[model samples]
Target: MKDKFEEAKPILTTLMAAGHQAFFVGGAVRDYLLGRESGDVDIATSARPEQVQALFQKVIPVGIEHGTVMVRHCGESYEVTTFRVEGEYSDFRHPDHVSFTSSIEEDLSRRDFTINAIAMDVEGGIVDPYHGQQDLRQQVLNTVRDASQRFLEDPLRMMRAARFVSQLGFRLSPNTKEALTTSRELLKEIAVERIAVEMEKLIAGRYVQEGVELLVESGLVHELPIFRNRNNLVPVLESVTSRPLQDMASFLSLLVHYSTIDVKTFMTEWKLSKATKNKAHTLLDGLERLSCDPLPYVLYRVGEELLDSFRELMDSVGYDQLHPKTSVGKLFKELPIKSRADLAVDGKDIKELFPDEKPGPWIQNLLNDIEYHVLLGQLQNDRNTIREWVIEWNPHDPS
Candidate 1:
């Protein structure tokens, strides 16, 4: 973890060289102690945002009002935030105001979780004011202060707790778990977009089952619109507990499992993208009769793009066994006509063969018929065979 921090350590060195105090902070420091390679290293500094910008050549005022600035140093970007105390958070999201301070203790105190609140210097000197190190070692997700007060400050902290539990395979402390259950409704005050983001990460985590259990046990899943009335919620979660779902789309299949609900309506309620909604629909739709040894027709129906994700979902949930990944790749690769575009004769070829016939939806219809025949092995995927077949099939026309 410290080696991962080496790339961005120069930023702290430069800040300190300019008569300011800077240290590796947040996830970077915490990950370093946990011996995991951390990404996007962050720094806590006594210097103001403008002071950080002045010291660095490429600085982005990403959240200057919140005492944060993106500093690009040594070909890496680091978020340098000033030590500060936050004002009341009325919206359960952002604090109304923040006052910059020289005390790192003040900044660490405001963080959501104890493990995330730990700070470390360049030489690996740790400042564990909240005993984040102890919590980290204990694999406990403990909040920095009275859980309810902190959650009252921002309810999304509850979701973050769930995500950390899944990502780090940690358990929530008794008080933290109690506060989360009681204040789960505060998530309503947070935005759906934020909740969706946390849910996505939570389901994609290595310990996703644990996270889902926490979501169920903590009663946090009820706060989200998409998960409010799910029947057989345990089975829904158990479906994904086999292993981490590949992505949000795969995770979504588990969400809509065995429920007497319209999938599109459920997805729309969650504000998912058309592509994601379609993938989830396609993947789930295939699962109805999907088997380990699907016939050629079934493979053709699933299409080349979605078959893999379908297989991934099936294998992840232990619903069915899948052949080797290459099996589908080779099967699709060898298909005579994999899609409409692969048909031997397209709309243009069909129109050229029947110059006297006026074009209508028939061109597409004929192309579909040809593609279907090619996939069924009843006709060859050759331009000449398809043209002759089309002219013979449409024998009423002059030929």
Candidate 2:
């Protein structure tokens, strides 16, 4: 499949054909130069948002005041933003006022980083006003114009700086690095949710250790939600191996494992989703159980759906050393039943086997016993075999 830029070329072509200057700007242009897969193709143009809406049949005024609209074309949506300059960042998140400009160069100046300040036209020409291409060549990440001013405008840029280190494996310029130390406290003004986004991406990047080091050195970690008080736990982030984590859930699991913090508190402080919280809980629980329980039993508890993620969590936390001879995958495959649902007999079936016994927690307990035996391959999953086994077993007898 063609990349996002190629797919959205017609939109650029159409905008230019309307006698307006337009170019593929921001991360899309940066990633294109880096030879990486860019996520979204954003168009920066001299045409105002109204002009853009007028030209495109399918236009969505998602952020019109900010000079942005979603242009639907060829089954893909591209954010077409007008070239503009901001007034003041009183909130440090959004610009207080914006004035549309015809110059892409002026618009590029307002961007956060030098690498993202470059622009590309439809015919593949670059507009590098601040020598972004040079920075890209040097593999150095720095802010546009003044580092302090740019960061003051938006503190999250500091987090993004460390994140870019992990993503691009680049070193921060001395000036940029110094600015991060001085302006790290501004990160407190940013929402935890936004900070969480960058933190997650930073840990998930290939150079996670480098990113964590930046976080520690820059003092940005001290500004984060939980890491602010737990300075000792911050270095623990460097313990993660070279292999990047699959996602935020794995990193959260790693944090909980090392710090032994309550999963619910972590979830609430970080403002994570319910699904993520539950996954972290499962991974943590699996690690605890794997230490004592048999491989098959632990696999059953972790469940098949989360087996791979659980294994990733295990590797991230260095739990793999405990099971040097064990192959979770191999053992899981050899199990007679993967889950309780796969058991031949249900609670109703077990209750029927013992009609005189009152229907209570005993049925679930008996199923657990059967499920364990079935998972260990000691008992067949066949219905008749399990029924006969249940008949011979005495639930009331301790023996």
Query: What is the Å distance of residue 57 in model 1 from its true position?
Result: 1.2
CA lDDT of every candidate: 0.80, 0.86
Give a tens-digit lDDT track for model 2, residues 1-399: 236777888888888899999999989889889998887888999999989999989999999999999999987888999999999999999999999999999999999999999999887899999999999999999899999999999999999999999999999999999999999999989999999999889987888888888988888889987777987876666675356887677877777777767777778888989989888888778888866777788888888888888878777666678666767788888788877778888989988877777788878888888888888778899999989888787444433
lDDT of model 1 at residue 141? Answer: 89
- Compute the lDDT of residue 267 as modeled in candidate 1: 76
Off by over 4 Å in 2: 319-334, 397-399
Per-residue CA lDDT of candidate 1, range 1-399, in tens? 356577887888888999888878888777778887676788999999989888888999999999999988767777899999999998888999999999898899999999999888888888889999999889998899899999999999999999988888999999999999999988888877788888888877889889888988878888876667664555656666667766667767756655555677777777877888877876776666565434455567678878777667657645544344436566677778777777767788888887888888877777767876787787899999878887787542432
Worst 10 residues of 1 by lDDT: 317-326
Error of 2 at 187 (Å): 1.0
